[model samples]
Target: MPKAQETILEIDRSALTHNYNYLKSKLQSKTKFLAVVKAFAYGNDAEKIAKHLQWLNVDYFAVAYTSEGVALREAGITKPILVLHPQIVNFKTIIKHCLEPSLYNTNVLNAFITVANEEAQTNYPVHIKFNTGLNRLGFWESDVDYIINKLKATSSIVITSIFSHLAASEDANEADFTVNQIKSFKVIATEFLSKLDYKPLLHLCNTSGVINYPEAHLDMVRCGIGLYGFGNSANEDKYLKPIASLKSIISQIHKIEPNETVGYNRAYVAKTYEKTATIPIGHADGIGRHLGNEKGYVIINGQKASIIGNVCMDMIMVNITTINCKEGDEVIIFDGNNKATDLATSLNTISYEIITSISQRVKRSFIE
Candidate 1:
């Protein structure tokens, strides 16, 4: 395939299927799968990714905001889209789009109920997020009584699922904490079931939770990073193929004399003569400012080139003195050869940040 003029994110559809099937293999036959397509499918075209996942027969889809769900609905995605963190102001829009909201606290819960009532919605599907230990979002265990009372008084909305998030499922040191979170969720789920006439789907596993804690698979599991081809662990990562490849082309090459500096703020001063290749991608393309001046490197023609100076808004200069390459030669910013996780580690972040930080300005090319 020909390279685009600027940086481009190449998404492999087959890798997505491979990751999905690998995660599905860890689940019980009856467990349903919810693919988290929020953040534009981790910054890789949500509608395109969701369409493929839907065709794969994924049982559900989830997004962090209401507008994301609405975008999916506009794209003609008929599958149930769960708005994980819906706001009170958008309750009407959420209802109008037929998007299920994750009612975490009393205010959001009550407001959603009011909207459902006004719209005359009956048994409108909604998910309940319980704060097991993450403490980010969800109802607390002590609020069980309040939750039951609220549900009993409202036929306008129905609890489709009761779920919680694991704060550290990937960390072995925090396994005990993850277990406690699971136990708390189970207790809360049981209490909810005892009060209600019907049983909603129960889920607590994210991508890491799915690979690390199989027993807590529950009724449905949400796969986010895993679906995008990362297992969050070395062992599991070996089994999954990274689906996104960020690529660019060298725009020009420059010969720098000794004592000559490169990029903004004179970030790099050559102690000796050096050859630098200017690539058409930088902080604006999600390569953070801190990733400049030898902090990060990119592969050009299968050779490693250290980033020489500060990353500019739309360009980066790489030390390519030893590499045999020229302008227009292909460069892999971060791909299977140089994993996004490794890049993230260098930046003290995660693959999610590295991948999702890629701007919309960069073209996205999908390969099946």
Candidate 2:
């Protein structure tokens, strides 16, 4: 690998393909794999990743907004794109880009119908989002009848799939709650579809759901984090490989005497003579200030280096006394060896936050 000028996120396409194949092998033979490319493919370049997955014959692609789907389309991706949290204002743009919207409520559904009709569209694909237990978005079970009735009245809209999100699928302790939510979703889907004389593909499995609840893997599975590696459970981790590796180079080195403080606010007072290396990465680069002050550390020369003092907006100082390295040496922030989950645990956060918090300023280099 070439030397990095600053913080760089190395994307391993081989690992991505490995994780996708692993997850695919775990799913039922009839279930389709929908790669969730929202949040820029979980902060790792969505367009490129989506195109690669499309080449691999992925069943579908999902994004959080119509613009995200539009990006994929612009990249020449022809796979079916599902917008999970589309706004009413973008319904026309969504229709124009041939992106499917997940109508979470009656208002969105009605608005999409109007736009589709005005555009002289016929059988435009749309997904129905049901609020199983997340309580964040999606339509209520009671509104199923109203949704079906409206769909029946409109000829331009077509229900492509009915899906729900899993709130606590990763937590084994929440198994009962997740099971109940799955049961409720199934009941509502069955009752509502029967009344409409329709059978849209039913799906309600996320990364953790697919791992924990095999029976809930109905017709499709939407996976986001698993594609990037770091599964919800320890067992799942054995089968997944992380695709992102964050690396930075040491910008400078300093020799500190005993009792001397490092960085702003004198947060880290040296106990003895120590050598610290300042890396060209900080809060502005997604290494939050909170991660400083002894909350987190990085790997240097195969050894752990404690982050000393406040993490500046553009730099961070790490004690390199134990490591046999000099200025311009490489340092690992989070990678295959030092998992993002481990860093997130040290910061009292989750892997999702650690990965998604990576700023766009970091240069991304993909390895095939």
Candidate 3:
């Protein structure tokens, strides 16, 4: 990829392909693959990422909201786009875009059925979500009968898949918990499918689950972070490559004298003389305030330059005294080398939070 001239997120398509293939290798040949492109494909340009995955012949695509599904539809994603969470208000728009909704609860299932009837539709495909362990969303095991009966009343809608979320498939300590969740899902699936005449696809594995649980692969798998090049474990990370590289150029360099202060509220005071570089990226650009005052560092001329003082809305000052660098030099916020995982670890966070937090205002360039 070319050097950054400004604050830009470089999207490496080749890395994305490699990650997809790596994850795909873990599944059975007949199993389906659903690529989760929610949160603007984890804040790396949804349309672009979705389009590339579509080209890879991914079986399906998943987004968190109706708008995201609609965006995929508008981008010419003909392969099924699953709206993981759909508001009742957007039901009509979702139908209009041919986006499938994951009916997780009584209200959503009933509301979607009503909308399907109003639209005068027939066999409109939808997915069912059940809460195995993740209490965040989905219906309970007891709701299976209610869902079956609800579906029995409507020819306007059809269940395409029944799925659940894995709470902690990545953690070894949570192995038993993960296994129980998978077992619960299997029991739910057996009962749910036995009642219906046709069989829809069943999926429960997220990225880490895809690696850790082969038995839970069911009929399909949904991959999100893994496609962005994070395997959720050190053992699996070497097999994948992160697709987004946040980079910028040094706007200016300041030579501070002893006792000099920097940034808002004089957050950093020079005990000894130091040189600082102002980078055109900060809180507004998704660089959090917690990263300020030496919590985070950037790669300058292959050397570490620790971030100093408070992070401003659109700029961050880094102490680069020892680095032999100047204005307009390339700066690596996070890349395959100084990984996003490393940055997130320093802040006691996860790679998912850090990558998805990248602001939309930053320019994007694709390594096609």
Scored by TM-score, the top model is: 3
lDDT of 2 by residue, 245-295 (tens): 999999999999999999888889999999999999999888998899878
For candidate 1, give the lDDT of residue 332. Answer: 91
Instruction: Quote each prediction's TM-score.
Output: 0.98, 0.97, 0.99
Worst 10 residues of 2 by lDDT: 1-10
Cα lDDT of all candidates, in order? Answer: 0.91, 0.91, 0.94
RMSD score of candidate 2 (Å): 1.3
Off by over 4 Å in 3: none
Residue 118 deviation, candidate 1, in Å?
1.3
Give every collision pair in model 2. Answer: none
Write one digit per residue (lDDT tens) for candidate 1, span 284-308: 8888888888989999888889997
In lDDT terms, how accurate is model 3? 0.94
Q: 80 in model 2: Cα distance from truth in Å?
A: 0.8
Backbone clash tally for model 1?
0
